[model samples]
Target: MTVRAAQRQVVTERLAGHLLASGLSRTSVRQLAAAAGISDRMLLYYFRDKAEALGEAMGHVAAQLGGRLEAALPAGRRMPPERLLAEAARIATEPEVRPFMALWMEVIAAAARGEAPYAGIASEVTT
Candidate 1:
């Protein structure tokens, strides 16, 4: 990857973890910069805008959650409903899952407010 892409990926991963743990809101540029261990200017250097940065973070979190679900699935057949429910319950109560749940809810709320950036991200990651 290009150095800029690598840096942005690193920041995005860190920022994703932070958002998942803390929940999303009107998280300021300064707050995201703090979570990313960089100045706001540098954060902007990596991301064109707050919405894009937030979208990238959401995508990363979704990828992780999806990876876990995929790993738990059977290779050649659909999972049974009971087993899927059990897995869903198991996942739901995980401490780590709570923040992502909050983040997703925030995204949904944002989309409900008619924010195109969030709606686009909601489609990208939730699908």
Candidate 2:
């Protein structure tokens, strides 16, 4: 990969960690850039826009959450949708998973408000 791509990945991962820890409450370009230890202009240079940056970060969070869930409940273990949701709820209570759940709630609230990035991200999560 190019040096620029690698640097973008590092910044994206830092943004993902920040999002998981703090949710989407403070996601201005400056705030996100600060979280990623980059200048706001550099963040824009790395990503197309704030939506793109946030989408990539939340996608990372979702992937992390999926991996944690798969570890706790391995694949090919089938259950009814309701039962699966219950199991997920139980798993969400675990400390490691709780932050993701909190972020999910924030995403849902943002989606409900018809917010950009989040509405799209929440749809990606649900569907």
Candidate 3:
């Protein structure tokens, strides 16, 4: 990836981590950018705006969770439905996953309310 792309990835990951730890409603992009040692202008430049940044961050979180799920799936094993359900339940109940779920739900709700940028992310998630 180009340096700028790498930087945006890092920023997105940091923002995801922050949102996961603090919950979505409480986070400010400016505060998160400062905490990540990035300039507000750089954050805007990378993401276009706070809403887009938040959507990108949510996408990052979703990709990470999907990776984890794929990795945790049994390989060449004939798992029973109950076992598969249990595994899914375990993943869903993980503490680390909780924040991402919260953020996703909040973003979707915001999108429903006509929140800009978030609508795109919510649509992405739904698709």
Candidate 4:
């Protein structure tokens, strides 16, 4: 990835971490940028707006979760319903994955409030 893309990923991950630690449902771009130790205008330059940045960040977390699920699937076979359900339960309840779940929920709530950037991300995660 390009340096800019890498920087965005770092910022997004930090923002998600901050939200999880603060138990916040949403965050302003300025607030996130401040917490991420970057200029607010830098955040705006990388992401059209707060919602887009948050969505991209949440997408990174979701991709990680998806990778875990893919690894857990049985080799050369579709994952059975039972296995899927068990994995879902594990992810939902596991402390390690809590931040990701929190970020996912936050993004979904944002999308519900007509946040266009997060709308597609929320749908993708639900499916």
Best by lDDT: 2
Q: For model 1, how does the per-residue alpha-carbon lDDT over 1-127 read when each residue is reduced to its tens digit?
A: 9999999999999989888877775468899999999999999999998888988988899988788767766457567889889888888778867777778888899888987688898988968
TM-score of each: 0.86, 0.90, 0.79, 0.72
Q: Find the 10 residues in a row with the least total lDDT in model 2.
A: 118-127
Query: Model 3 over residues 1-127: C-alpha lDDT tens digits?
Result: 9999998989998888877777656557678787557988888889888877877777778888778778888468779999999988898888867776777778878888997767887888667
Model 2: which residue pairs collide? Answer: none
**Predicted candidate 2 versus true structure: per-residue lDDT over 1-127, tens digit per residue:** 9999999999989999999888888899999999999999999999999999998888888888889988978999888999988988899898888899999999999999998878988887776
lDDT of 3: 0.79
Per-residue lDDT of model 4, residues 1-127, tens digit only? 9999889878888876676666344467778888788999999978898867766666666777777666766458667799878877886778877776777777778788987767886886667
Least accurate stretch of 10 residues (summed lDDT) in model 4? 17-26
Q: Model 1 clash pairs?
A: none
Task: Pull out the clashing pairs in model 3.
Answer: none
The reply for model 3, stretches above 4 Å from the true place, is 74-82
| RMSD of each predicted structure | 1.9, 1.8, 2.4, 2.9
Clashes of 4: 0
Per-candidate Cα lDDT values, in order, are 0.85, 0.90, 0.79, 0.74
Residues forming the 10-long window of minimal summed lDDT in candidate 3: 21-30
Instruction: Give stretches of model 4 more than 4 Å off.
Output: 23-26, 74-80, 113-117, 124-127
